[model samples]
Target: MDDSRAKGPPADADINLTEPAPVEASLTDNPQKLKIAYEQTILYARDLNLKIGELKQAEKALRQNAADLAVLFEASQVFLSQNNIETTLQTACQLIVSRFDLQLSWVGVLTNDENEIHPAAVYPPHDHSDSHPLNQVGASSAAGQELIRQAIHTTQAVASRYSEPEARQAQPAALTDDAYSLAALPLLHNGEVLGVMSVYSRQPDYFTPDRLQILQSFANLTAVALVKARLFERLQLLSQQLVDAQEAERRHIARELHDEIGQTLTAVKINLQAMQRRSGVSDLTASLQESMDIVEQAIQQVRNLSLDLRPSLLDDLGLVATLRWYLDRQARWAGLSTQLTVTPSNLQLPANLETVCFRLVQEALTNALRHAQAQTIQVDLQQHDKELQLVIGDDGLGFEVEPTLKRVAYGKGLGLVGMQERVSLLGGRFELESAPGQGTQIRVFLPVPPALAEDRSA
Candidate 1:
């Protein structure tokens, strides 16, 4: 064969075609296609780059979402920690402005006078310095007042972009000029609108739908706190009224006893003394003296009864003197050995507080004399560091303390329940310690009002 014809193709063609075609390679044994291999490598690199970019974007979004959730949780904790109304609103405003980075945050309650809204609390605009004049108007001003009105009227949350002229005009100059975003959320509980909360930001569209929803949740918590505060106030008022009524009734009864029964006893004693003075035989004289003694005893009994109803000693002398007189008389009458120790004598207390203290002492002594087969009793009173301390102990056969508190038969006559009630009214703590074969001791701790302790020694 000729060499040129045997080569099958020209040298240029053979050199240019470095790899066999797919169909030719399949027919043959092997195929080395470098161009196709290089093209496949380039396509894989492009796909990898695209996947990396997508992953970076997804991570950024996830981080932002986590930050938003953390802020919401912090705001919720702030709302739950407040126990009073004023503090609750203040906390809410601070959280909104600080955590959410808003320019201004405030809360307003609908005024009783249907036309006005009262600003309760506000966080000043972010750019305003603490000493700036504009910072002073967070709680009181025309801007704050009107914002409240708009929130109340809408009843639903309102979010508006500052670029809109209508929205700009509706807002206050301080807010519109300095704040580019604003949102108002209504506070509702049990289908009733209590107030509205408003927030502002320096950047337009700063507050998203998710942020508004979180703010609304804060408003709901505020409503519950306010309701609780109001209810507590009402209860305090009612309790004071009841106390005033009780005092009035006591005064009325005291007057009746002094005017009616007291006068009658005085007249009876006078008549008996007059009869004895009249000339009489020896036998008649002895009989008349005995009758006069009996009349005098009756007079003393009437006086004691009047005192028990309401003690005049409480007003005439201080708590110590009154207690001393009461214990002396009861101990002598009941045939019980009683020792009273009151340190820092002549100390004075408020009339109501004194009355409570006296009654507690009186009841405790009475119970010991009547029920406890004790030989000796001790009453101690002292004052220490803004508190009044009382301890009454008796060397009698002690009984179970729990059963006595429950008024069980073994402790029926202890009067623990009555003593507990009296202590509670004064916002004091009462404790009783007793066990079989041991003496019983009652302890009372009462807080002294600052007004009473001012300028006084403990």
Candidate 2:
């Protein structure tokens, strides 16, 4: 091949193959310089790595902060809207699991036992079940359980990590480096430790001290809400008792009027009639007849008062019969046409439930007749599934329902509020619908106990 176009290497005759290759003048020529250069490069890499690590930590912190805020905002909204304790706790658990994308979350309350806590609620929103209500704490996740105890005992937040196998095995066993995270936060409020709430995540070290602090804030809110809920429930119970007392008082007064006063008035009227018949003088006869007429009016007034206070039919004849009689009498007095319907006409209910039902209808009718200028009123009652339903309607000049109820709630009027309170105290749902130039309608749904429903059905 031609030398100019050849691709192969030159002939070996011109090269020194046996001799050592020449050294280039560079840092390698001096051990000191080479070491210094290598050290400098290492230093540069170390500094860069440190800065990068710090930035990553800062970014992670910001992301975690945003997540914490989102969780708190959503939970606070629920806390603001719902005042019921069970609802608040249940919703809080759901929010935590949903927000954190957590594996599970559970709430443990102070039980009779001082050494351990009991599960009050769990995540995934169970169907009113106790099976696995404790999620992982009751059975395993030993590290988590200990942390829960420590958090509750100290009223502080305790955190740890656990692997899936460790969690599933649920033994109070040691955990490995690679594991899920668990944070036990105390439900501390008013300087009292009510219980503990624990959350789990697949991401190890997810609940850092700062993250736990944010969760603790939510736990604190949940604790306060629980206290408020407890107080509210107690208040509801007292209010229910108050209503029951009022009903009893009314019954007592009605009985007194019907029995004692009615008899006395009747006796007086009979004596007056006897006196008028036996008297021969015209003046005396006229006087006696007037006295008898007054007695008759007095007797009629007493009877009306007795019925209005508390009708005997309410107790002796059940809710349906009592409602029929009450609606009829009120309709006649107000010159309104009343239509009442009851499925399974002989429907019977518990005494307290019957009283509540009767009172609700009574208030609705009174409001419709006295305020609505309604000429036709309808009352419907029926039992369906696990609840009793009642609907009352009237063709009257209706007013704004919300404003009226708000005013009533603020003590402006009791007509609308009394109806609502009566239903609420019994843990029932009450809704009012009305508008100007439109007739009013009141809908009520009262939960019936399973046992009571069975009895009624039988």
Candidate 3:
């Protein structure tokens, strides 16, 4: 009933209705207080600016760390993916040159003499002309110029600014600009310097401590890979030597048995035959004939054993005749049809080549007989101007090729590995093709001089 009066009446007794109340004391009005307020505002603004700057710095650091991790990841992938030293260095250098702010990258292996760092792989920069070139600098020099040499000698990472005279002298040429730095890390494994990895960048002081640590890790991984490759190569060499020694021993034994036992048997048979012809008593003649027959059989057995050890035909008649003889024998024994085609019919190969070809064919045939359950096989051999090629094929149930490779790598398929090593030792190529149900084929190419065939034929 009186809502307006009730809302207005209780507050009216001693109050001014219209005039604004006296302004309260505040920093907004007083000079000093206002100045203080302005100063505080400025201080807060400055603090905000500083905080933003710090946040930006943190963001940049995070980005840099991410890039470093990515680079390390790629280096690790390189170590995992590549088994060859040349390919590994090439790929790893390329990755670094592409991903990082780098001008050039190179990898050099320490020679056994420890005198030189031979450049194994190099990744040139965007402007190839301005790129820092790799120099084969001596490790022990008075100049102290070679970062790579220093790193290797100390088995540590070394860094230098491109502007330094000694560092500049160590580089291939003057940089297009002075804004560059260099770092060299020793590739060390088990306390030995395997090689050196050098990187060039377009920023001064590019090799920070954090980056140096990552690079050192990369170098270590590279060294481990190099060691593994070296061990494999050494193992292959030892295997080849063992195979050679075995062959030599076989040849020696075969020669001794043929020369000593074969001749004696032949002489004994001739004497017995003469005795049989001259004997007066029937019983004595019969006994002499029987002895002659026994000696002849023994001689035949000795000849067979000698041939098996190392065929005289392989030495005398050469690979062609021996292969023909062997193929004929295999056809009879294994009951498999074989077709062999050797171009020019009068090809003569080096002893190693002949032995490798013969062994390859022999092993192929043996595998077919023992495992393939195949009926027919084909072999093609050709001599080219710069290479010799061999192709062998079979019509049998095939198998997965990858698992076989893994097995060979782990030393299980020695026959296959032996064949491969023989070809590789001669700088040849060997390849196999197969599948679950189709068939199997082997192809080989051996780099050879054209004159090799002609010289042997002559």
Candidate 4:
């Protein structure tokens, strides 16, 4: 029984005592494996850090993109809802600066000559001084000038660094210390450049390709919005002008009726009553003659009024006859010499086109008489295949063409805008040529509808 506890297990007990523990066995027996495992763990931690950094960058980019999208979406809605171009553009500039953390923002329109960029909308509005500091910076600096030229000439989005020391010196005091990068996106429609949207950013390489694309689209949307707003305003003005023209026509008709017809009828009635009171055959005859004279005068007055309202010849004969009648009448009334020439004497035109042509000549003659103080005016109408061409020229005091066009655009240039609108609505072309002291010339070309052309040929 004592053998179970001692003598048989002596060697086994000695072996167990000499053997290492599990934790120590791993470290001491396989040092290379331990080092490899440690290296692997370290590498895994380093990889995890790198992945985390990449994830953070991705998140940041996502957030920026989201913010950009939000700003653009809101801007679209703002532009859509806004009816005034100035308000729309100003609000857009303000939004861009605030949302994108930009230093400044502006929208510039190319002048008619395309030689200058006039600031249309600006954030942190320029001072009341005659000179716009930022605008001067844009015009004066080489980089700034190139940026504008590139965008306008190429009709694309252009970007340039605006960190030149000289350019910075040209900046206003508020923006002198800060660096800037400028991006110009051309406002384009149907391959024509309307203007440029200039944005300034603090960060370098801020406008990525994606960002630029978004901005270009925004610029395009803005261009369309501006054009729509302009058209809307023009329509409103036209509506008001139409109302005014109707009122004026009504007044004129009323005056003519009162002055000519009413007076003649009153005189005739008085004479007839006098004749009724006196019983002489000669008196009756005299009264009858007087009444007939008055009647003839009244007839002439009515005829004039009718012609003024809408010439019967326009509906009966055509545009050419109406033009001749109106020009003769106006020339006689104004004591101005006038000449009208129509090629292919028997040429025909659409009814509406004829009316338009007549009104255009009438307005032109009126302007020449009233404003131009012209001695002579000439009108020429020609049909060239599928197009009708008209030229109205006057030897009179002229005006600055560009300024006059501006006035017309704003609804001010004595019926010139109306003429342009009429031509444009008919898918026609209108052009004006004038200078100080030189005579004014208006040229219009209207395309003939296929049906009308066919009718003429037939």
Candidate 5:
């Protein structure tokens, strides 16, 4: 080898600059370096375990949140659809207990006269049995009662444990010894505390802040349902008053047409006949006879007008008689077959119910002739137990019932809508069934109040 070549640096033996560095520790021969790397590895494992634990906790929380939202959504749907107050509150109490898995739940209404709560509904309804301690929820634990009062007074949600000092101070007597914890949320609407919804839990520390928030949402929905129910009740009263006033006006007009115009026309015809008899001249007698004919026609028209407005028979003879007469006459005029069936042959109803039944039939029959184009019509009136039912069926050209009724608001289906409003005002049910090429049938059910039913049976 040349002396100059030996002076050059030797080439590397085991190195690849193109490859990436190894991430795994080599634990080099140096003792200090190995010790430092080992300690760092232990710390990294500890932090990894901590991160895994937090992820599990986050997943559990998300599941609980999802369940709570589902319950709230379902409750909102039910509350909006219900129009009865008692049913709405009862359902709310039932849902809270069943979904949350609690010991007891109840709703109490604070009446205007009483300072304390009056129990309205309870979950695990009282069976009047001694088997279950939770049955007597109306007389709840001391803590539960106190929580309700606090919620009402403060207009806020309250919670307490029976073993707590405050709970013991509320009442020394353990009325709710079975419940370990209690919570109450106020039912508030329009600045008014309507009631309180209370819950009892057998587990300690069960009612957390998140759970209270969910319960408050339920209370808010319940308040909305209460407002809707009261408004519906008021609307019903106003509707009935309107119907009564309209009927009164019709009665007045009918009387004027029949009593005043009818009598005067009859008197004129009588006088004209007398004149014809007294006058012997042919020219004058012929003229008097023609005048008598005109007066008779006028009298007949006046009588028809009075009957159409508000039939006197509806007042004097009752519903059945008026129905029979109207159906018979209308059938003859329209050249169609008609039938009216009265159950028990002596069925009678309250005056308002009677009016509703007759008008319903009248309007239905008119629609059948104008829209259905049917040749035959049938009306059935039956009193079954505490309910009075009327069914009007016709074999005519039929149309979609729902679409036509929906048009009522726009004034196109006033005749059908009028019948529905009349029934609704009385807290009754109305059902209309019709399809193209199918006959139309209208069914109405009016409840006979307990007082009237008793009188009827007697």
Candidate 6:
């Protein structure tokens, strides 16, 4: 009997016995099935584990990207806000130190000679010993110098795991014994290299290609910032130079008028007096008197011209006395009612500050006399803390303060421009307020020098 028939299934009668029995296989005959199942299970588990690892890696990359983006955004904002090289570099250094886990980072700006680079920013790693020779890299080292030069010339990023021969020769003790990696990136703007950014690591292969690329991008951004800061500095220098030249010219003109025209007027007055003394006849008396009157008028004109060029009172006396003299003259000439108020009567200011204040007052009075058709003017000077303030107001039929009015009215009026320039040169604040049917008010605020303030107090 067949072994299957011998073991007949009679316990479960519901099952048909003679159904040509489905193809049957024993565990012993196909023992490889167990091994195959085990292999498939291992592969499936491995694939799942790999997928999980990939997801984690992707998440980590995403977070890093976000962090980098945030840093770039902050850097951009800071770059735009600052207007000078020192502040910009300081901000950049702080940001990099705060954001990156860097061993060493620094910015090297090309010097005027273009052969040397100056350290603008430097961040030393925590583990770096203060006595290490690398500490002097920024000051004097072939490696640092060559890195800067290469970055500037190539306008591209460079990295080196091994110390260059020249650098080792220049600072053998520093590089020969130390195994530090370096990266140098060109800071470029508008296809021009402005500077170099360098980073150092005590460990070999500390930076990857991707990290170098990121640094290069940061360098590009920094380049724009540096360019903007440099441009701003240049503009400021040019403006200051122009102001200095203009002031020098004005002083020269003022001196010329006082020495030349003033002396001639004095001589004319002397001659007229002599002629009047010699002529005693009544017929000639009238002519001589007329001549005397003309000479007196000429003398007055000459004095006025001299005063306009540079007030003698300003140089001889202080701002308050000079302003008093100016107001008296203006009141007499314009025939306008004038009021003067001065607080802290013993107020004295720096020479430059005094000059600015006097000029502002003079310009305001001139504007009122020439254009303001006002009958009454008030001039006030006050001191508070470290500040000196001057306010000149007039009860004039004021014009609109709109741009159109400013362009038309102030175009012909150099008084406003002159006053503004004086105040600006003194590092003061100036404001003009006026509207149609409203009176004009000119206010100036100047910071008093400590020495002058002490002198006034004394």
Best by TM-score: 5
Q: Which of the two, 2 or 4, has more TM-score?
A: 2
Task: Determine which window of 10 residues in candidate 1 has minimal summed lDDT.
Answer: 11-20
TM-score of 5: 0.82
- Per-residue alpha-carbon lDDT of model 5 for 1-458, expressed as tens digits? 24542232233332222222333455576777676555555545554555566679899999999998998899888877776777887888888888888766788888887486778877777665544434322246555667777898899888876555544443324354433667888988976898888887766688889888888877877877877877887888888999999899999999999999999999999999988889999999999989989999999999998888899999999999999999999988899899999985888778999889989988998889888889999999988778888999999989886677778767887897799899988878999899999999999999998886787777
Model 6 residue 358 lDDT score? 75
Model 2 over residues 321-371: C-alpha lDDT tens digits?
Answer: 888888888877888898988976877788999998887887888777678
The positional error of residue 334 in candidate 1, measured at the CA in angstroms, is: 3.9
lDDT, model 1, position 372: 74
Give the 10-residue window scoring lowest on summed lDDT in candidate 4.
12-21
Whose lDDT is higher: candidate 2's or candidate 6's? 2
Sorting all predicted structures by lDDT, with the top scorer first, yields 5, 2, 3, 4, 6, 1
Candidate achieving the largest lDDT:
5
Off by over 4 Å in 4: 1-29, 113-116, 128-136, 162-178, 253-458
Error of 6 at 255 (Å): 4.4
Off by over 4 Å in 3: 1-95, 99-101, 106-132, 135-144, 163-175, 278-297, 332-335, 343-348, 384-387, 397-413, 427-429, 435-437, 449-458
Which residue pairs collide in model 1, if any?
A: none
Q: Which one wins by TM-score: 3 or 5?
A: 5
Model 1 per-residue lDDT tens digits across residues 1-458: 24443333432332222332334344334334454444445544544555566679899878867876787677666655554577777777777778667766777777776565577777653344543323433334345445555666766666665556544544445443543656677778786778788776667776677666766766776677667756655665676567657766776677677778778877887886787788477777787778878867877776777778677777778688888888788878878788888766756778777877887888877777677787788989887758889999998888887766666444465466656756665667888898988988999998888866664653
TM-score of each prediction: 0.57, 0.81, 0.72, 0.49, 0.82, 0.60
Q: In model 3, state the lDDT of residue 43.
A: 46
lDDT of each: 0.68, 0.79, 0.76, 0.75, 0.80, 0.72
Q: Name the weakest run of 10 consecutive residues (lDDT summed) in model 3.
A: 135-144
- After superposing candidate 6 on the true structure, give the runs of residues whose Cα lies further than 4 Å from its correct spot: 1-83, 91-106, 121-150, 158-185, 189-192, 197-256, 280-283, 335-345, 373-415, 421-434, 437-458
Query: How many backbone collisions does model 3 have?
Result: 0
All models, RMSD in angstroms: 12.5, 11.5, 11.7, 22.6, 10.1, 12.1
Model 6 gets an lDDT of 0.72
Give a tens-digit lDDT track for model 4, residues 1-458.
Answer: 23342222332232221222224456667877666555545544555555677679899989978887787788778888776678877876787778777766778887889787877898758665534545544433465677878889889898865555754665555554445677888988777888888877766577778778878877887787788778877776786567457646754675667667767776776766666566468767776767767776776776677567666677778888878888888878888898999987987887668867887888888788888889999999998778899999999998899988888777797598778877865768899998878989999999999987777667
Please give the lDDT score for candidate 2: 0.79
